[model samples]
Target chain A: MTSVFLLQWQRFRRAPLMVLSFLALTIVFVMVMAGSNPGNSMTVPTYAHPALAEQQQDEWLEQLNKSEGLQFELVEEQEARQAVLDGDTGMALQLMEDDYRLLIVADDPNRFEVESYINRTYAEELRIRQLEQQSTSGEARERVAEMLEEPALTVETQSLEGEQESFVYDGQLQMLFGMALFFSIYTIMFSLMKIVEEKKFGTWNRLILSPLDKWQVYMGHLLYSFTIGYVQIVLVLVLFKYLFNFDVGDQFGLLLLITAVYTFSIVALSMLVMGLVQSPQQLQAVVPIVATGMAMIGGAFWPIELVTNNMLLAISKVLPITYGLDALKSVAIHGRGLTELMEPIAVMLLIGVVCMGIGINLMERKR
Target chain B: MLETEELTKVFKSKAAVDGVSLYLDKGESVGLLGPNGAGKSTTISMISTLSKPTTGDVRLDGRSVVKDPGKMRKVLGVVPQEIALYEDLSAYENLQFFGRIYGLSGSRLEQAIQQALELVGLKERQKEIVKTYSGGMQRRINIAAAMMHEPELIIMDEPTVGIDPQSRSHILEMVRQLNKEKGLTVLYTSHYMEEVERLCDRVYIMDHGTIIASGTKDELKSILSGEETIWIELDRPYPELFAELAAHPEIVQAAETEKGIKLIIPKGKRILGSIFQSAERHQAQILNVNVQTPTLEDVFLHLTGRKLRD
Candidate 1:
């Protein structure tokens, strides 16, 4: 067993691509999917209406551009509304009956920002006009200006000690975790691919011919698979924590433990795949199907709540990742502890044992 | 120190290795001679404990290892016919791994790896990955991997199946060095007659999953004592006339060839006159003819009435 483990380690080091693919691809996933969208900046379009006074239009244009949080352009009236409906832009501002109205679709991430900006800008313009008409004296105008400057109601935000529902599109944590789980499939396939290479290279016969116990051979590979998957998950997690300053909540230790177990189960499951398939081509065909299907059902790609089918959701409950996500979400987001979440850890371990047992057992029988 | 008694294996209704008994004394080189599918590998497999015998037992140092194959594995270094190595790993890494599993440790394991690499003349390039190696280099490393433990007996199964002649000679020389200079025992198997003739003191000829003959090379060849072989390359096929020559009293054996036939005749016999007469009658012109002393190939022919390659 020691020999097998050492050999596998040496082999892994020699094939730098194998190690780098996991880290490199995961980093890309982090950058593309989990990148911080610090507060949004958007641009919208409207039309140059012929009926509006030129000076008022210029004043409104200057204010809207400065405060839209994003840049906008002037298009024809129909084109402006159509762009919003066609999903070209999230929202658009239109001038109507001595006021302004914002056009939007049913779903948009920038709905609140657009609506508030439009209302505040138009209300301030109307207030200034009303005050100027009533007070012509300089002293009265100064008093009215001071009164209008004060806010009607002050709103301050304070977060309580509880799970916070996500109101922003910061997918960094979810993307990071999803990629880590998805890569366990690669670890599994590569692990089995090494076995196939052994058979082709004829080293498998030497192993069989050796006096070493069969478990040592299987266990060595099993451990290597775990190590590879575990290392990749850790690297990605650490990046998210230190580089992005992303919140992994307080239970870092418990989160690490569950992830390690999750990786073990995934590696063992891959070993099962290796035991069943005889060639690299078979591995390529089978692994993608199995891993993608599992990730999809396990909520690694998108949240399971996004899935509307009851039958599909019910099936996903049996998958190992559902428990992994549940356990991970509890510890990383909800601040749960090991004692409070015993069942998921136990279930992950159970899956690992069953998978590793059957996989190694089949290989031993083959020998 | 190894022996098999009536060992057998049955795959479904067919027997791959039938009842056969063979033995190897200490510090002796023995050859298992047979064509393909003659159960040489199957017998080796059972002896190596990679497969179990259906009946009988393999005894190591006068002890049966049917139920458990332990003690013998410690003292035996096996070189499978296949390369049997990790190509992605460097040669040194491969040797170290094999040596460690064989129970060597620390500096002792290091020494064994170095010695094995040097034995195969691959120490200088040991750091390079095996995938970068030529076929012969890989074969040498394969042999080196087996020798890491310095086992009492080294069992090689057709170690030179498809290799350039230069590497083939190098491997043969390495085996000779291990067996003769080091006093290591060897159990070598091959289909090539010349390899066995040049290497082993004793030989076993196998056919149809059983040993037909086993003796010293000279002793086995003595089965067709005072025999001379005739090579007849004809212009065309001569089945009818060849049949006549086969039925003659002096012709010991006759096997057909693509162009003509090969005849094994008794020594000091004047059978060429009758052969030429038969060929003339068949209207087949003899392109070439040569007579030589009996070889292991001829002995195989005399015993089975078929070519060794057949």
Candidate 2:
């Protein structure tokens, strides 16, 4: 195993550009995902009524006019609505129920400040209206303010295993996991192409003719590819964590375990590629096409929700990347604990086993 | 000792190597001689356990290689016809990698690499990348890479192909040294008759995936006993002269060359007279005439009815 690891390290060291490329791409992905909008599902508005349009406009204009430092722009209602929908505006004001209705759009799920600000402003307006109607004293308004400032109730969710939802790296973990899965496929294809090139160059024949068993040769190549995949994941995770503050979640041990398993599965897949391909160019073309296609359908670049239910989903479930993504999202986005991810872990292990069996059989047949 | 019995290799429906049997003594250097696609490589591949024979058995030291290939693989060093080497790696690194794969390590592996490099006369340039080396140097290193394990039997398949004359001579010398000094048995394969004649103690001539002939140099030459090969050098001659020479009853075979004509004839006094009469009738001037002994090329040509090059 040490020999295999050393050989793998050597191969990785020889191809530093690949390592750098994977890391760079993962950083880019992490940044993109971290900065991206979580869409309309997570956005919460301050008010829900649809009437009182002119009253809200007059109030917003007065507030903007009194502001000394901030720039203000008042466009037509339709344009403002379009801007909010297009993720161009953060919030839009409209009239409803003889009061101001603030339409707050959160481009990021973590932007709770804007939503809270809108909610507090509406609460203050409601309190002022009540004081004017009932002649409440200043002290009573202060008390009302104190009551309104109390923290919201928090609800904790857990998986079926009774473990708390631990996935909490702010979605960076999920993005990193997805990108790592994407690059694992690429690494496996690259390694298989290298094998085919070695065979074309006749180096494989020499190695086989040596005193080493066929298993050793196969292991050496697998080790090299495994290390490549492992290092790629590690570098991407590190870069995202340090450079972009992209969270990989707090479950470091579990993340590493999943990465290692994913590496093994990719390496096994690479061996199978080597077995199936007869030429270097063929391996280059076939492995990437198959791997990238699998990744696309397996939810590497996008969520599996894009594919919905179909044969692709069924096939994607069998791929290690699908399980990796599920586990990663659980740990990173939903704050799921290790005990909650046994299913994805098991799926990944099953993929590794199946791929390795096929790969080994193919290698033996190659002989 | 290395031996193969009734070895056969079939690819799809084509038999690349038909049923063949041969043996080598503990220190003997045997050669497999044949033209391209004669199954020499296929035979060696099976012997080295790089490929399995469709039906056959290979034995090293009376132990079945087919039954226990691991044991045979440990004792056999194979230099394939293609230069099987990592061009991106330095010669030393390539040797070290192969040595490690063969389970050689530390001081033993270092010593083996040094000795192999010395044997091939590439010790000084071992640190240079193989791709940077000359074709001959690369070929020598390819052989050295195989020798790192110091196996008892070395199987070299067409090691001299595409090599320069100097490198070819160097490789042949190394083979001889390894066999004579180290007592290493060799199964050398090539189509070049001269290389086989110079290096092999015994030879097997394969054609169309089967051993057509097998014998020592003297035994193979004896097949054409009592027949003398005559060469007549002419400055310039009419095209009809060859026809005239070919029509002679005494001459068994005649071929024209740029400088001369070569003829094979039976051991009879009438052949020289008949050749002279034919040359005179064609008005050809013979500058030099010499009678020579038959070479392996002659034997191949006689058996196959085609020139060795053809």
Candidate 3:
């Protein structure tokens, strides 16, 4: 087993392009998609309607700018319209006294976030004005503001994983985790494809006819795939955490544990794929399809919270990457502990075992 | 030291090798001769413990290796038909890995690598990557990898299939030295009649998943010794005369050659006079005629009625 494992490392040293290219792609994709200030805020150009006075428009701008997740910038109506038309910004907001209009020229994923922010701000400001109109003391607005500082009643939002704050999406960590795990699929599956190549080229028969046990050979190959995948993901995560200043939470050890389980699950999943394939060319076509499909359907490209289709959510339940992304986000965003993470971890291990058993059985049956 | 008794392997109810029984003594080099799809590879795969026999026994030194292949694997080395070495790795590294798998380590492993490389005549180029080498060089390294542990029995399956003559000769000579000098028992399989004739002390002619004949080379060739093959060359097509000769009483077997016709007749026959008369009646011009003693090729042709390559 050691001999076979060591030989794989030597081969990897001779041609490290496939693995390295995946790692580099992960870095490039995250940097490009997430942009400079991920999760901090999204900037949306805003302009007041001409019927509104300058003073009222300034008040609306101040109220809209109070949101922590969406930054509203005041601009001339013509400039905001031109910004959307020229494709500079994906959307622009035109504010009215009682309502607002969104001039969207292109589809933007962050459009939901900006709209949610403006809706809540407008409702609160309008209600305060209404309260002030009905009050005889004429200090209803001030009292409402003071009362909001210390609310009489609050509803605590928690998840199944014990006590937790409301969900706060960290785009930097999301991109970092999502891309790292997604690209690691390619690294792991392509590395495991060596087993198929060896069988095709007949080197597998050489090892089988040798004195080594059959299980030893399999263990060697599987261990190599696991290690390479684990390293790529960890390295990518570390680089993003330290070099790019992405906040991946302070539970570093828990993060490593999650990566290990995810890597194992992926390795076993790759094994199942290998067993289904007949040749290396078939596997080459399969790896990308499996990787990209799993990423898209399993919520690696976007958060599962945003995916609402019942059938897709049902399919995501069976995929290891779904649990992997969930566990990772729970760790980074929700700050959940190990006990809370048991569900995802156990699900991942179950997938690993089931897939590995079926995979090896199918492969041996073919032989 | 090794034998298989009625060994059979069936895939999806089709027998790849059926009722094959052959044996090899220690230090003897035997050949398995057959065309493609003759189950030569399947037979060797079963014998080498790479595949399980569906309903037979492969015994190594009186112990059924089918039950326990560990001992057999420890003493057997297989050189597969394909170039099986890791192309991305250097030849030296490939040998080192194979050696280690067979329990060689430290100085012993290093010595085994050196000896295997030396045996294949690639010691000087051992450090080069296998993918960078020519096809012949890669083939040599393939043989070297199987030789890493110096097993007592080496099963080589068409080791010289697609190599240059120089490399083929080098491989044949190396096999001879290994068998004669090192006393390494060999079960070499090939479709090329000359390779088997040159390297094997005994030969087994197989076709359609069964061994038709097995014996020493002389013993196999003697199957056709009762008659001699006559090659009669004509200037052009003489279908009528060739048909007449084929219908002749004493012509045991007649086949049309590229030039004219080939006939197998009694060794002491003097039917050249009748052949000439028939040719003259047809006005067919004779180019040349030659009579030759029976070779393994003739013996195979006489038995199977097909060319060795066909």
Candidate 4:
């Protein structure tokens, strides 16, 4: 076992380009996620003499001492603008006049209530001032206040259909999972093809005819491929977490479990390819075509949602990558608990076992 | 002792190795001499457990290899016709890998590798990758790799093919040394008759997937004793000389060329003097005269009606 591990390590060491690709992919992921969102951008300062402007506005409002009519508060321009837009505040008062007269800047285009309030208050104030010149009458003041108090219309905001945010994040997580699955499968298949090439070149025969049993040679190759696939998955996941801001949510344990399952399935599929194909070139040309196509249709490169029909979806559901992606998406993006993802996880595990059984059977048959 | 009993291998409809039986005593060097496609390599492959014989059984010390190849594999070393060393790996590394596969490890493995390399006279250059070595050097290392496990029986399938004469001789010498000094039984296969004649204690000449002749050099030579081979060189020989040589009572076979006439006489010593006297009468000056014993090649030609190379 130690020798097998050492041999595998040697194979990995020899394939530095693959490792470098994984690292580069992580960087690309980080770059894409970091640069895509604009909401995270810093705010630009647009205020000039903000404190002085607020003080002047407040002092001017104080001078218009008929405070019973209406009043405005000095606030940050952005905050004030937002409140007006949201219909939280009636209107903003930047300046006011004092001759039983008043001025208001109507931020809302349909400021009907605020306008009425201003009009009635001004009228009442004029009447009070005139009455003060002669005789102050409480009945006249009450009449003016009564005229100002117009009935207000109540409005309720609601939508007929409930809003459900589309599972876009789930889709993205599926894509990442799909990519990881595809890469892992591709790596294992490629490694197997490399071994076939070695065989064709007589390198394998040299090793086999040497005092080694079939198992040692097989295990050495298996370890090399397994390590490659495992590393590819790790790199893709790390990239998802950091670069894509991919919330592989919180299920680290579930993610690891899914990853292990996917790795085994891919490795077993590779062994099947190796067992069936005699020539290295044949293995190389055929494996990626079949594996990549399966992954694509199974929703690795694109979301399964794009295939709207029930039949295609049903077919995708049966694919190993589909189950793998589903489990990953459930764990990573939806933050689904383990129980929620058990079905897909179980399917993935089953696929791994079935593939392994078939792969070993095929190998034994060849022998 | 290694024995193959009625061993046969069929590839599709054609028999690659027909019912063939042969044996090599322990510590004895036996050679399989045949032309290309003579099933020499196939026979070696089956005997070494690298390939399965379609029918028949191979036994090492009376233990059936067919029933339990693993047991046979344990005691067998194979040096294939093609150089089987890993081109990318150093000679020592290749040896180490094979040694480990044969269940040699630790200091024992190291000692075995060293001994094998020394036996092949390649210990000094063992650190170099096999690809970096000359063709002959690679061949030597190829054989050395097989020897690493120090198996009781060594099977070499045309180990000297395509090698230079010096390297070929060196490999042959190494094989002889291994057999003589270490008492390692060897089943050597080659097309070169001289190689077998030099190194093999016994020779089996095969053709068309069947062994046609098998014996010691002298024994095989004795097979052609009824016919004496006579070689005569002349400045110029007439076509009629062929007829004249064929007419001799003792001459069993005759072939004439522009420069000479070769006659196979049943009793050469009695008839050679008469043939020379007859040649003198025909005004044929004998530039050279020689009477020789039959070699393995002659035995092969006599039995198969074709030269070994043909």
Candidate 5:
């Protein structure tokens, strides 16, 4: 087993381009896509309407800039319009006395985020102004703000299971985890392709004729694939977390554990695919399809929360990537501990064992 | 030291190897000669314990290995027909891994790799990746990988199927040394007649999954001892003259070869004069003529009515 495992590493060293390319791709994709929305924040250019006073626009800007996830910059109306027209920004916010309008230009994925932020800020500031108008004294808005800060009646929303219901979306960590897991599929499946090549070329028979057991031979290849995939995910996560300063929360250890389980599950899934295919060329065609399809259905390209179809959500429950992404987000975004992540970890492990058992059985039966 | 008893393998109701029984003594190089799809590779697979025979047993040292292949596998080294080494790795790396697979380690594994490389005449190029090597060099590394463990018996399945003559000769010489000097029991299979004729001490000629003949090279050639082969080299194919020669009572069998018509005639026959007369009458040009003693090729043609490489 050691010999076979070590052999794969030696072979990988000689032809490390495929695996390294995947690692580089994961980094590059995350750096470009997730890096564009660091800290889930975007800078929106704000300009006051010609009828609005400068003092009122400054107050609106102050309220809008209070949001940690959005930066509202005050600029001249002409300059803001020019920026939007020139495609320097996706959209610009025009401040009015009682309302605001978004001057749209090019389409942006983060456009909704900017709109939601401005809408909430405008509503709150307008309500406060209305409250100030109805008061005999002019301190009514300040008193309302103080009361809102510490509400007399607080509503704590929870699921029927008594768990807190809150959705925290960090675009950076989502891209980091999604692309890391997605590209690791390519790395794992392609590495496992060595088994199909060995069988096709008859090197497998040489190992069989040796003193080593058949399980040892399989374990050698499986272990190598698992290690490569695990390392790629961990390395990408660490690089983004430290180098790029992407927030993965404080549960680095849990993320590592999740990564290990996810890597194992993917390795086993790759083995099952290997058993179903006849040749390496067939595997080469199938790997990308499986990876891309799983990424699409399991929410590697987007958060599972965004997928509304019940059928797709049901299918995602069976896919290991669903659990992988869910568990990773739970740790990185929700700050969940290992105890809360037991469900996903257990599901991933179960999937790994079942797929590995079926895969090895199918392969051995073919033999 | 090893034998298979009535080894039969069936695939989807078609018997690939039907009741093939052959044996190898200690330090003997045996050849299994057959055309493609004659079930030679299948038989080797069963004996090497890489596959299970449908209805037979393979025994090593008087123990049935059909149920327990570990005993047979322990002493077996198989050089498959395909180039089986990892192409991306160097020859040294492939040999080192094969050695470790057989439980060799430390200095022993290194020594075994160097020894195998030297035996295959590839020691100087051991550090180069196998994919960068020529087909012949890749094949040499293929054999060297199998030799890494220094097994008691080595089974080679067409190790020189497609290679340059020089590399083929090199492999043949290496196998000869391994058998003669190292006393490694060898079971070599090929469709090429000369390779088997020159290397094997005993030859088994198979056709359609059955062993048609098995004896020493000289003993097998004696099957055609009463006949001699006439090589009539012509300028081109003369179908009419070939038909005339084939119809003659003195010629037992006349087949068109690449060169010209080859006639199997009874010994001490004086049919050359008549052959020339027929050729002249047909306006055929005879480039050359030579009569030679029978070889394994003739024996195979006599038994199966087909060439060894057909």
Candidate 6:
């Protein structure tokens, strides 16, 4: 086993693409997220109607501040319209005499909430004015004001892990975590592909002919994948925390723990693919489809909260990376501890075991 | 000592190797000779523990290696038909890795690597990656990788199939030296009869998986002891006369060739008159007529009624 491990380590060290692509891909994701969001925070920017009266403008701004998690900005009416046209602002609004008009960009994840918030805010203000006018008597008007002060039915969201952060959408940090978890599977893919390579090149048969047991060869490869994944995660996280001043919460050890288990599952999945494919070239076609599809469905491309489709959310739950990335988020952003992370970690291990069993059976059948 | 008892391997309802039994004494060099797709590689793979036989057993000094081949593996070195060395690693690195897997370590592993590289004549370029080497060089390193562990038996399966003539000779010489000077037991398999004729003390000729004949050179040649083999190369085809000549009772076996015909006849110079008369009656121009003693090739032809290569 040690011999196989050392050999794989040497061989992997020679594969510069593995390390280079990991860093390059993570960097690209981080930059795209940071560049897209203002101040590199996850909050999408919002602006009130610039045509409103100055006094009403302040009121509208105040309401936006309390309505959602967006960062609200104020600008002239023409400037805001142009911003929307040029795809600068996430959403734009115009207040007409009787109703309001909103211009939304295509396929915005937050379109529904922004539209709902603006419409609700405007309708509520109009409804209050109507109530004040209709109730002319001092007692009735005072009652209307009191009722508008706070709604009788309101929800209070509580964080089970820890303190609720001011902005839940730190895009830069989420992108880092997503990409870290997403691309970590590539190592396992490459590692498992070695099985095909050995068979093609006749080395696998030679290894079998050697004195070493077959289990030793597998252990060496699995350990290599796990170790390389750990190193990649640590490298990215360290760079973000120190060099880029990216906050990764306080529970870093838990982060590593989740990543380790997640990587184990990824390696096991790659083995399953290896057992299915007959050649390294076959893996070339298979790995991208499986990895990309899983990552896309697993919400690695975007936050699950941002995914509005219930069916998609269900699929994400079934993907191993979904739990992995979630546990990572719980550690790096939510400051969650081991117990809070138990669900995802356990699910990942379960996936690991199932994939490993199936992979071993398939590989054995091929032998 | 190594022995196989009726080893058989089947794939998709057809046997690739069928009921082959062979024995090799310690310090003996044995050759397994067969054409392509004749189950030579399959037989070697089964013996090397790379393939599990469908039935029967392969034994190393009396211990069956069918179920658990650990002990047998320790004492065997296998050089596959393919260039199995790691292309991304240096020759020395490939040797070191194989050595470690064979349980060598520390200074001993280093010594093994050095000795293997020197034996393969790749000591100077040991630091270069194997992919950078020529095909023959890669094949040499492949052989070197097998020898790093110094097993009791070295099984080479068609090691010189595709290489420069110089490298082929170099490998043949190496195999001969390893067998003669070091007294290493060898199980050499090849379609090239001359290689086996020069290097192996005993030979097993296999066709379609099973061993058809096994004996010393003289003993195998004795299969055609009472017959003289004749080769006649003609300028043109003589199908009709060739077919008629094949029906001759005195001719033990007759095969028509692209050029003319080959005949195995009972030993007697007087039969030459009848052969010449038949050729003349067919109006065939015999450019050359050669009579020779039976070789391993002739023995294979006599037993299987087919050429060793075809």
**lDDT: which candidate is best?**
5
Q: Which lDDT value does model 5 have at B231? A: 91
lDDT of 1 by residue, A1-367 (tens): 8778777877777776866887888788767766543223356787655677767677788767886245657778888878888887777777653587677776786778677777787787677667677776746546766776896766766558455444332255567677777876687568657776776666776776677876777677777778877888888888878887767777777888988889887887777777787677888899889888988988887777678899989888667787887777767766778997899888878887888788767655655
Relative to the real complex, the DockQ score for model 2 comes to 0.51
Expressed as tens digits, the lDDT of each residue in B1-119 for candidate 4 is: 88999999998889999999999999999999998989998888788776789999998889998887777777778888787655766888778877776668899999999998888
Q: Write the per-residue lDDT of candidate 5 for residues A83-122, one digit (tens) a residue.
A: 9999888999999988999999778888887888788878
Better of 1 and 3 by lDDT: 3
Off by over 4 Å in 6: A37-69, A72-82, A91-174, A245-247, A304-317, A332-335, B233-250, B254-261, B269-288
Task: Score residue B252 of candidate 3 by CA lDDT.
Answer: 83
Rank the candidate models, highest lDDT first. 5, 3, 6, 1, 2, 4
Pairs of residues at least 3 apart in sequence or in different chains that clash in candidate 3 = none
Model 1 chain A TM-score equals 0.68
- Scored by lDDT, model 1 comes in at 0.80
**What is candidate 3's lDDT per residue for A1-367, written digit by digit as tens?**
9988998998899899989999999999899877853776778899989898888888998888887767889999999999999988889999888889999987887788778778888898999888888899999988988898999998876788786555677777778888999999999999999999999999999889887788999999999999999999999988888988777888989999999999999999999999999999999999999999999989888887788899999999999999999999899877899999999999999999999999998888778
lDDT per residue (tens digit) for residues A166-200 in model 6: 43666766678778877777766876677778878
What ordering of candidates by TM-score runs from best to worst?
5, 3, 6, 1, 2, 4
| Model 2 chain A weakest 10-residue run by lDDT | A39-48
Interface RMSD of each: 1.6, 2.1, 0.8, 3.0, 0.8, 1.1
CAPRI tier of model 6: medium
Per-residue lDDT of B291 in model 1: 91
- In the range B7-95, model 1's lDDT, one tens digit per residue, is 89888888888997999988889999988888999998898887899887999888877666777777878898988877777898888
RMSD (CA, angstroms), candidate 1: 6.7
Lowest summed-lDDT stretch of 10 residues in model 5 chain A? A159-168
Q: Flag the better candidate by DockQ, 4 or 5.
A: 5
**Model 4 lDDT, residue A266, Cα:** 72
Name the lDDT value of residue A121 in candidate 1.
71
Candidate 6: clashing pairs of residues: A42-A169
